[model samples]
Target chain A: MTLAQWSFDLLLAGGLLWLGWQALFEKRRFSAVVHFMAFNLLMALVWVRLSAPDIALAEAAIGAGVTGALLLTALGRLPSGTSSGAHPHRWHPHWRYLAVISACISTAWLIAVVPQLPSPGLAGEIEAVMPATGVDHAVTAVLLNIRALDTLLEVAVMLAAVVLVWSLGPTLRPLPPATILPGLPALSRLLHPLFLLVPTYLLWRGTHAPGGAFPAGAVLGAGGVLMLLADEVGWMQRQHWQRLLRLLLVSGLALFVLVGLGGLLMTGTFLSIPLGVARLLIMAVEIAMALSIALMLMALYLYGEPGQ
Target chain B: MSDYYATVAALLCGMAVIGLFRAHDLLHRILALNVLASAVFLLLVTLARTESGTDPVPHVMVLTGIVVAVSTTAAALALTIRAYERRRQREDER
Candidate 1:
């Protein structure tokens, strides 16, 4: 690598470490959150430096963007007047010092001793079968085709999460949204079409490039969060609308299973697409999953039923 | 250069563990947990770097992990909010 490249990586590494520390050790929870979001966004750049474009996109949308919004919402809901960020320790928590010291020692030792893992693992194998998986992108093929069982389980996990959170009972939504900036509603309205179009474009482009369901769904979910933050989702309070949202949340997992079953019947093995219709089947599952992921993430941001 | 990342990852893991251990607040703990997760993601991706190119398999694993991490974080946040609200409500009644 060039000297310039070396320095760039050094700066990125320093920034990540500093941000990670700030995200936790900072006195204010709010600042910690902001640091955490910055850390994730920087991590996306790290992924790009490592030549992992797919993960870079996913990290940017889901990690840096949606997670920041979720943290902000949770912060608002936390009961106030508590002595936040004030620990009653007489001295620094000694156990923490011990832990960090031991962890660093062990981690350094392990890296020095452990042999490097042979690279090109599974990339060669996955790439060879990419054409059969119906996607030109290796990551998508690995995610949705060759080892689709993992993806299936992941969608199910998303469903389970929504169900668990929903059972936590309704909390109050911030009415009149005292927290949002005055101009955000107008901005959210302006960008609303891009929110819809961008995800669609990503989903369509996923077959050939770095775009795919996870990032697209995350972008859509972030849009939902934007609408919620701007207090423009008044219609979500309707009793019947809750049922529709619930169905949408459940549809991703259900459709994945149904598609898996269909694949089983068509081919002898389950979850394996026939070579002839690989593209069609993968795209179908991807669309259903993207929609479901979008709703599930949005519902998660709601934290509970939308308060009237 | 990737070794530099490995060292960073190691340091992150250590720091995040300390943060997770020392944090008294639920939100602080969650943030530390996330930092820890990012450390693991970084280590794996760095390892996936080969003389030829970056590997796709570990990339897939880390991507799925990112989605999973967000879901769990949301669930944890929801639980935290519920418990805090209930405690406040109980105090009000008392």
Candidate 2:
């Protein structure tokens, strides 16, 4: 390994640790949010360094961008006393001491054991079966084809989360009503085109490269969030769009299940697309997943009960 | 090598766990959980690397993990925010 590469790696690792500590220990809520966002950005870079560009793109969009927005919104909405600062509690000292000790032991155990574990070399297996999946990108192939049940369940999880948040419902009042911040309208208008274009490009490139439904969905979700914050999402609550929103919310999982059922009826196995139509099926599923994931993420962000 | 990342991941895991124990605030606890999730992903990706290249399976897993983490975080923060508001209202009545 080159000296420069080693130095870069060390620097990145050190920065991540410092940022994480600051995010955790900062007394002020705003500073902690800043630190956490920085930590997320650095984490994305680390993924890229680790040679997982697909994961890197998803991390940057969903992990850093959408999650940061959610945290900041929660910070704004939370009652005053319960800000980010650690509150005093009985038995705090004992618990903290125990925590530190456990942390040390676990760290030691992982360090000692991780290197000794064998690599299952799943990459080669993925490569060998790549031709059958019809997607050129291995990550997409695995996500949409080989181990697709996980992805289907993942979509279900997102929908379930939105349901959970909605079931919690609005508090005594509906979150102080959404207010438009200064300059947000102009900003949303300016970036609106990019949101549509980027997600489309991402979905197209996903069949061949390091982009896919998740990142594309995240980008679109961000756009939805921007619209929400700008108070431009009133149309979403209209009677006509309500059903559309509901349908979009469940489309990914529904399409996924239907395709799996189709495979079962045609072939003996479930979710096994025939070789001739693999590419089309995968693309159809990816597009549906992207749309459904985007709507689900945006709904999760709004934190409003759907039927209200 | 990937081992260096593994060590970093371990340290991060430790920090996050400690943070969770000490964080009394709900937001702090959620943030700690996020850090811990990041550590797990780092470990997975580091382990996925082979002599030829990185494994797509773990990469896909981490991608799924990121989405799941966000969904859970959103739900958790929503609950926390509602609880805090309810507590404030009760104090007001008192």
Best by lDDT: 2
Stretches > 4 Å off in candidate 2: A82-89, A92-95, A170-180
lDDT score, candidate 2, position A281: 92
Error of 1 at A237 (Å): 2.2
The sequence of per-residue lDDT tens digits that candidate 1 reaches over residues B1-94 is 6777877887888788878877878898999999999999988888887666667888889988999999999999888888887877887999
Model 2: how far residue A59 lies from native, Å:
0.7
Worst 10 residues of 1 chain A by lDDT: A79-88
How many collisions between residues are there in candidate 2?
0
Candidate 2 yields a Cα-based lDDT of: 0.86
Q: Write the per-residue lDDT of candidate 2 for residues A1-308, one digit (tens) a residue.
A: 89999999989999999999999888677788889999999999999898888888888888888899889888888755645333556576777678688789978998889898787688778889998888899989999999999999999899889888878864223322356468887888999999999999999999999898988998898888877777677766566777888888999999999999999988879999887888999999999999998888888877776545
**Chain A TM-score of each model, in the order shown?**
0.90, 0.92
TM-score of each model, paired residue for residue = 0.93, 0.94
Pairs of colliding residues, candidate 1: none
Q: Docking category for candidate 2?
A: medium
